[model samples]
Target: MKKLFFAFMLCTATLSYAAEGTDTTSVMLGKNKVVIHNDSLGISVSIFDSEGHQWKKTREVNFVDGQEVEQVFVFSPFIPLRKNTKRTFYPHFPDFYYGANLLNANSNVVMRDTKSSEWGFSPCQIGLSLNKQNTLGLVSSLQFGFVHNHFNTSSVIKRVEEETCMLPLEEKDVTTSFLKYYYVKLPIMVEWQKRLGRRKIFAGGGLALEYRYKEVSKYRIDKQKHTVSRDLGINALGINAEAYVGFGSVNLYAHYALTPLFKKGINAMPFGVGIGITM
Candidate 1:
């Protein structure tokens, strides 16, 4: 009989305590429940939040194809998501980025004969960075790229009259010449990206140094050299800028070439578009 009375008293006390704490949230300490990871190229940003998860945003870094932006805090409002905070935020980017560039040029280095040939190179890139806490942020990135171009050039040969025993043609004899060249190359760039509003429209500019060792000319005589001065531009240095519309994993980008296509203006303005990936 005494044991029963004690058990009843314990149960009544437990009920009273639950009633007192019913309307208040529990206070627990730790990191957010989501997981974060960085890619090797580092030009991207990504996040994953599962149900019943919390996080407090920690250190965030970004890379593009292995190159990273020099500066970090170019965006605004630094309210980053914490590590242990709950994963209730939507409109977040997944963990991958891949894209191609349609247009290209060598404004400061080599030049191509056709204006349309500048549209030959197709560049690819990836991005990894943290979510913007406020409206502004300090974001860094890396970028790598390459181009494959194939084109032909034809020029008219003027007529000339000559008195040489070997030549029935005149010194001003009319003739024609054509040349074709093929090249493959790669470039590396580093730049910062800024995000605004929910749509995340941002612009970034960076410098890339490229190397091209494969510019081979096909001669009229397959067995003989085409010209005494047959040299392809192997090493070229230049600059480029890009504007992108950010929507998590998808980004619409517009790119431009700041340098001329050769030692002189052999190639004209170069630009093009494709898809881009953000982590």
Candidate 2:
């Protein structure tokens, strides 16, 4: 009986020594065992239930050589907790956007005998814009819009009949004569935008190309209606310089024409200031 009791105590001591042998430990995930071992530099992780699944990641110093080395390892489920760096990602859409602008156009005809400037409100400057993402805080856009301008000239008209033979039969002084010009303009610009709280501010400038397609003139002399339509042999193609500043989805812009309104006789430089909206 004394020999049997001594043998039982020795077996219990052996089992306790085996259970508390080393710092190497294991956890069970279902039927798989994930083993972890702490080293002098870092930790070694292994999966005993899966074949060939083991890796080691060193910290600031190497365990065996005691030299400084970078922490390198493949991404896995056993990564250490680290402070993540912050980053910002902006969303971009490669689609077309429709917008409109209400412009007060100041149009002037450049001629030797006439110094006429017309200021009118053009309400329907509508178009589409395509936007592309460039770099941070920068974006490129291609925009085109249909624009209209009206010019009113108050001048005199001399009437001569066939019987009068080059002599003026009557003189009509016209007031409030209307001249309308229609154009389709294209503007290419790069915008720099910044975010402040919930609002965004943007400022940009670009070149504009305008093509005039139609011109019409109408007036009333002595209570009688008279309309005259003629192709103002003006330069159909015009170039403009533009700049703008705005907040949110609204912007105020200014444009100055670098080319003449008419090809010959009239050297008109057109300019305007307007407000636009983007959706």
Candidate 3:
């Protein structure tokens, strides 16, 4: 009986020593409850809440004579994963931005006895930044504007009016003539961007389709005005390439069309430099 009592006491002491070697604690983090367990080999963290229990992570740190050799963390899934608090307020995913563009537009076509200058503006541009990495995005815009071409030859002006058949200019009655081409343009592009010290630079190329709805020629002779409107049957499709550098909410950009502005005679390519404002 004494030997049996001695064996039972030894077993109880062994169990106590094993239990004393490990430590455990429970902590409340926000709405979640977390349990931390530290043993000879490692430390483990487990989370429990209304969602039930889940094991988060286990970290191994060596120990020498009951002293831990390194520090470790018990992370909770409910907490944010960012290591830098300064970056916690920044957006970490895709977002949308709206902007406007103002461009000085011109064409590559060389018209005889004509000097041309054109400008375009777009008040609506909707874009999406695909990631917080700010590397890729998409932009789509609608532009409504006009192109003004001044002609020095009355023969050229009369030719345009006679071809459209809507307006005919008398060859002897016209002194000065100019043509206005009104257009509605739509462009969609995929872009890549890089942020550089308060400035962001981007480059992209895409398809731009334009509709020239009305072409009007204005002729002046003897201080009298005459106007003729016609459907110019201009080709409305084009491809464009663009690049931009931005600072804060403002951007300066350049654009070049890869295709001609019109399908037939006088193959004119459109190119422009512009400014944009973002919100």
Candidate 4:
């Protein structure tokens, strides 16, 4: 209701100003200028960008024989009038972030509230613009991530025949123990972007296919370092759901694993939340 009233008042003011002989009234809508023009024939409306380029224009309305007559002389801004010379492919840039890696304890009864940390970097990202305005597009990226999981109690994952389970570590002198892994991911997403003056806002959501390429268990016992490399019953391929939103170059991003981390006998779903910067 308030918006309608404001529009009514603005239209009344524009008509009043237009009646004062070959005059125009202008208003700023964001960085664009909207101008209402009046002449001997009729009244017309036009919109211009901050750089004084005409963005859009509306038809004129003339008063003839005491009745309103509309004139049609408008061009759509979306229609391409010139040849295309812009590049079709461009770099999507990359994001670097660190966050906590959480496991769903309800699915895995043996594991307690395990504290974990993860960090990643996307060194390569390629994009293809789907529209001429570059507002919508598709992006594909390659990211590498490292995760470290710390157990509060003395525990270690041990293989029992065909199954794997976490058992108490026998080494009483063990001061610290943790499991770490590195993984590579490939993600593809559909993204949308909008420009507002000098700043731009963007949002995207997509799916990522990841593989845990390496894993290791480390322990410091009595000032001595020990390491073990094994399969650990972890799945090789993981599917994830990911999304991001941001203003300008900085963005908040999240990734949730859609599949279990372990192949059998245990259920652990991993997820990460962090901030990302373009480039």
Candidate 5:
């Protein structure tokens, strides 16, 4: 904007010099035509749009040393240079989303099949629009969530020595066994939005840093439940890559864990596909 204003002033000064030589003159600045009319009283400059509509006119009196001189400067009231644009703030985080979680393992690694799922919600979110149109922006938010790893059969997750390992349930009556993680995540993304008819659509992708604060393992043997809470050799800090596209307030997203799901031994990656809604 500053550059544009300077360019306008520079053009005005150059036009003022030219106005002294002619009683009536017209010059084209890009698409707009500037007309200068000089008479005995003073000089008046008029700016006409591409359609030849006159939108602005100005008359001026100049002072040189002790003598008074007349001059005129015309500027467009509605500059074609991104008129009526300003930076603004909005909400960018998804209010709620649920997804199915799965693990991808190396071909050489042997792991049991289990059903995993995750759900999360953003309690606080904010975005800063880079321009007046609000088409491009930066978003940051805090998400609190849980991931549950449920064993398909009678099995439980156990940490032995320094490795988290899966073990089959010794009790024949065991019906369910699962591991759950509670986490807080911080995500930052650059988003682009577009208007389609009356609907607005957006797409964004970014990195999220997550801290898994608590871990719980549980198993139920014929109504008898056993629960344990402890560090299970899992990675405390996790990095995730996420992308989403949506129209209006709803979006579909995919998330992939960039870092390993565990600290050591297990070479597995966790990923998910989900739908989210923004407030």
Candidate 6:
């Protein structure tokens, strides 16, 4: 908005210099369309259209500074209006286009696929989808994405297995710390959207699947580490529900992870925000 206002002001200021000695002048637009004649401070323009209406904002009447006087000729406004006419318009796009955002996710929780209560990144997989957002609406796109989570955690296991705990039997003692199953994933949610606003507002949803490349779990005791990892074929996948608002190609979005990020019985809620662009 500021840029547009500044541009308008700049054009107005530069008009005087452009006017020069060219006082009495006329600008003609094709046959029987429109004509503009100008002097120093005054402008005169005429339009007699046989059919369609042609319009230009400031582009039409850029009369330079002149004392002779000028009359602004907004020919298009004078032309008769048409009911149904098809016209195409191009929308502005960002430099990196749509799918070029460097994204990263962080959290405060131990990422345990079985326990959501652990303090850590609950999302075993966080990724961005490119194919999901090809065109702003109803068009296909390629999605670039990633998923990563890891934690070196130690929890007091005395609740169920106090006998095995090194702490005093009557009081909470040594805590059992473990570096359990860590997984890094990359996946895409191929999806589409419906155009909802003049500023590119849209709402859509899609499926996101993750392929885990690494997984390992271990228990640490007295400087000694032991393996305690489990496997579930990287089932860390779910449906992505989203809502968004945008301008041109730029957009801001929020999403909810409907599927339980971890196996049942874990305490975790997955939600996130992101900045995106339309391809």
Q: Who wins the TM-score comparison?
A: 5
Q: Where does candidate 2 have its weakest 10-residue lDDT segment?
A: 160-169
lDDT of 5 by residue, 1-279 (tens): 354345445554665677455676667777666665666655455556664666532444432443666545465443433232246445446799888776765553333344578899998977788877778888888999888776644556667767766766677877777777888988888888887876678888999998986787787777787884466777989899978888888978888999987776656677878888877
Ranking by TM-score: 5, 4, 3, 2, 1, 6
Better of 1 and 4 by lDDT: 4
lDDT of 6 by residue, 79-126 (tens): 334321222112221122122111122233344433221111212322
Give the alpha-carbon lDDT of every model: 0.35, 0.46, 0.51, 0.69, 0.71, 0.36
**Which regions of candidate 5 fall more than 4 Å away from where they truly are?**
1-85, 89-91, 106-115, 131-133
Per-residue lDDT of candidate 1, residues 65-116 (tens digit): 5455544554332234433223222222212323333324323222233322
Question: Which one wins by lDDT: 2 or 6?
Answer: 2
lDDT of 5: 0.71
Better of 2 and 5 by TM-score: 5
Tens-digit lDDT track of model 3 for 115-211: 4545566766656666665476677777666666655434333225323212234567666666667677677777676667755555655666666
Worst 10 residues of 6 by lDDT: 94-103
Whose TM-score is higher: candidate 2's or candidate 3's? 3
Q: Ten consecutive residues with minimal summed lDDT in candidate 1?
A: 157-166
Q: Which candidate is the best by lDDT?
A: 5
Per-model TM values vs. the true structure: 0.38, 0.45, 0.47, 0.62, 0.63, 0.32
lDDT computed for candidate 4 = 0.69
Q: Higher-lDDT candidate among 1 and 6?
A: 6
Q: Write the per-residue lDDT of candidate 2 for residues 1-279, one digit (tens) a residue.
A: 253234334433343365444546565554445555545554344443322244333332222343444565566433323311122222121122222222222233211123223222223232222333322332334343433332333431112231101112133575445445666566655555566667677776778787776655455566775655444565688888867777776767777888866554434566666566654
The full ranking of all candidates by lDDT, starting with the best, is 5, 4, 3, 2, 6, 1
Candidate 3 residue pairs that clash: none
